[model samples]
Target: MRTSLQFIFLLVYASVAACCQGQEVTISPDVVYGHKSGLAMTCDVFTPEQDANGAAVLFMVSGGWFSNWSPPEQTQHMFKPLTDKGFTVFAVRHGSSPKFSIAEAVDDVRRSVRFIRGNADRFEVDPDRIGVFGMSAGGHLSLMLGTASDEGNAESKDPVEHISDRVNAVVAYVAPTDLRVMAKDAPDRLPAYDRFPALEIDAKSATADSPIIFVTADDAPTLLLAGAKDDLVPISYSRNIEAAFEKAGVTSELIEFENAGHGFGGEDAKKATEAMVNWFVTHLDK
Candidate 1:
């Protein structure tokens, strides 16, 4: 029994070592986005290989519209696991809603991708093959990055104003796609906010800015993973966006988990992760 256990340990170590060798891992944080009062967003860049002209993924963290919790270790589950599979990953953070409006958070994510793409050579990443992924609100942001781009200016001095942040592909896990619908019907499931003055579903450009509203044939391919039982971010979120994707003749897919909820764990979550990885492999790993 002792010998068997030792042999298994040795095998695991060897596999992990083999996967990690020749891979350069960098966890750079506080990548400044702008200069305001305490005005700087942070992200951790995880570069896995030196020779990787491969696609990179920006993994956005899932906090609700309210700005309270920092992204925890579980947030790493989406990106770090992908790094071992030979991809560069960036964990992006943005100011939360209420404290910052949806417009502000959207712009923050857009700027983060632009910064990563602009520094592609420095990071050994492929500029044209970047992808984005997130869960819940972060997922919605990821999809927005893929769909909405009126072609941003790339020559400004403002770090946030200097580039187009469009991505090649997107993966969203139980994200709110139609904020108008969500804001109206989802408050019961969402976090109760007595302080931030609950926003109206129809308020301030949510309809026009929704990922579902922006889908087109020119949009990037998308992979949406939703839990059927997700109360906070209903399965209807993915369905609405998918309907729009099909109408626009864009390539996108939604994988629904029968027994999962808003946030998943266990075998169901693993399957969802595998599906997401395969989606990126198909669309962005070319």
Candidate 2:
């Protein structure tokens, strides 16, 4: 269930004092999380001087799954809030679509979770407290991470594959819930929509791997924020997921901005960010 508008503002204002008191942060260069299609899938890590509550946040910043990753400097501002909360942040990038699909992106995120948790001590993080966050297609992948996490395979020769990929929490923005509804209602908003008809991200093909279909009570606690007027990936994208989470008795929330659209910014962005911070704090800090 969603929080009230007053609660959102109060939560934001009240939590401002809980920040890490302007702690400095250390950053990591692009480190490989996985290798596929002869490409190095990597991420940048930001570590607060105070060790960030001994937890790490995995950020998937891909837009429509086509990521253009740069050095940590270019994206530092985005993670400042998390760092202020004393949470290490990992900006994760995945292979693009058209050339790559949602399936690969899903694998990339799950693998990143395993990689970060597997190296938690080296990174000075709590292996049990990794939380995933993203917007749009990235958010969709984050949801997949929440719904499809698994204990690593003991039989696997690769250690990373043997490390659990489950995250404690998720914060998603404007993400599609069902690829079937997404493709049918607004194919133009989907990645590689030009070939959507032939793509496997539909109802007839929706599998346990598809995020929406994959959800269960075991899914991570999630906070979803969206714009009521978003025509691209409509608020229904999140609403449907909210319903699914409720049906499965998963802890989830949805906030719909009455006056907003696809681009969530200004005051709405502040609220969304605050909601995310509160969600992470409540779910991860424990």
Candidate 3:
């Protein structure tokens, strides 16, 4: 058993180190996806071989909406399943909040997706076969992208900005779909939120931008995963989103992991990862 586990580990490690097997892996780290106030917004791109499946996954690495000047490398291992399965991944890091408001972070993520889609040929991915996945605050951004995609002005000089930001699919792990509802769900958190500048807004303002308000039949297929015990965001957020999706007649699902919290662990995480891969495969091909 130990040997089998070791072998699996080695296989994944080799793939992560050298890119997945169809063609040579081309890793372009810190590729600037956008420019914000003289600052460059970059994403780590992992491209597969030419004979690849031609699908792409945009993975967001955000927590607490706090912008990080440096994009983290921790995402590579977590996304190997998608890469190995022939999906290119763009590990997108948004302008963190507090230092940079969540609104800016939302813009950065949308711009990154446009950048990826704009350069789909260069990135060896299909422009229309894109998916976005994120956890926590990252999940919030992911949801916003799905609910709020738009095509840029075709007359714009910037080619990247001129492209559409719509994705084929979206997967949000433990995301807060409605902050207004979340605030009401847990009034005790008000004190903590009071310390923060941007999050201290009234419920109406928060609800105005929540993903639940944006549900439409035209929205992309989405999968919302939540742990039953997640006190931070709560499963109710996902449940409410799931209900909205159904009301809108959009393809959507909610998966609640038992004995899990804000993040999944051990087998739960593995299953969630597998579900993400399956979702992309199921939707991207169609």
Candidate 4:
């Protein structure tokens, strides 16, 4: 009986230790209604317990611009490790394409950030320390939210409308930088690409929307992770963005894994998580 009790205690202790080992970031999903109409949009907020004005990360999930698929578990888990390290994290959901236009989806993501920043007091997040994170389609959304800042509708009376959507840092994994161009380059996607409207990105708009195009001395710090073998988003896209950051004298780094492809899992995913944590620690620590 003594041995059995000891074993049970050990198991419980181990469980509690694991839970308390790193920073305990809690994730909660909340709904943010659209302006004028109460159309509901959901965003997940990951907050650190006992937080003292720590930085925050607004995470977006990947879904190929389709609302039919609900938010993935991976999206919330990716930000957990970060919260363990002391950052409040937010996993935001936006309107997807087809059901909603891409522009409207972009607006959704932008407002999600604003909502978080606007409620910093309730979340115990340092509004200035907020950053952005995303993978694949979410990666594309993160880039757009971080780079394109001119589209916010300042006339709205919504409480979320008054918050600034700008982010201090960015961590993107396999994010599509040049969407229209990438679609043109992809053979498999080309046949199925009838969903979106004509690719009408003019040079100015493309330059404005592309994260790579927005890299400048004034740009926020960024970290990019990509798979070298990813046929979906060529490694060159990351390279181009890095090059632009370099040209503009911005701080940025790109990590490419030779064996990984598309989405990472297991060890590769672990490495990606560590890289993300380090990036945020370096930038948000201040």
Q: What is the alpha-carbon lDDT for the whole of candidate 4?
A: 0.65
Whole-model lDDT values for every prediction: 0.69, 0.76, 0.75, 0.65
Residue 83's lDDT within candidate 3 is: 71
Output the lDDT of residue 115, model 4.
75
Residue pairs in collision within model 2: 52-86
Candidate 1 lDDT over 10-100, as tens digits, reads 2322333343334445555556644445777767777764544378988775355433223433333335456766788787777765567
Give the poorly placed runs of model 2, Cα more than 4 Å off.
1-21, 184-192, 195-203, 206-209
Error of 1 at 5 (Å): 38
Question: lDDT by residue for model 4 over 235-283, one digit each (tens)?
Answer: 8878888888888887889999889766665567767777887888888
Task: Give the poorly placed runs of model 3, Cα more than 4 Å off.
Answer: 1-24, 67-74, 155-157, 182-198
Candidate 2, residue 99: how far the Cα is off, in Å = 1.9
Q: Tens-digit lDDT track for model 3 on 48-163?
A: 65546899999776766654333334435546677767788887877765667666778788888888888888887889999998777778888998887888869989787788
Model 3, residue 5: what's the lDDT?
A: 19
Model 4 poorest ten-residue lDDT run: 1-10
TM-scores of the candidates are 0.81, 0.86, 0.85, 0.78
For model 1, the stretches where C-alpha displacement exceeds 4 angstroms are: 1-24, 49-53, 66-78, 154-160, 184-201
Give Cα distance to truth, residue 131, candidate 3, Å: 0.2
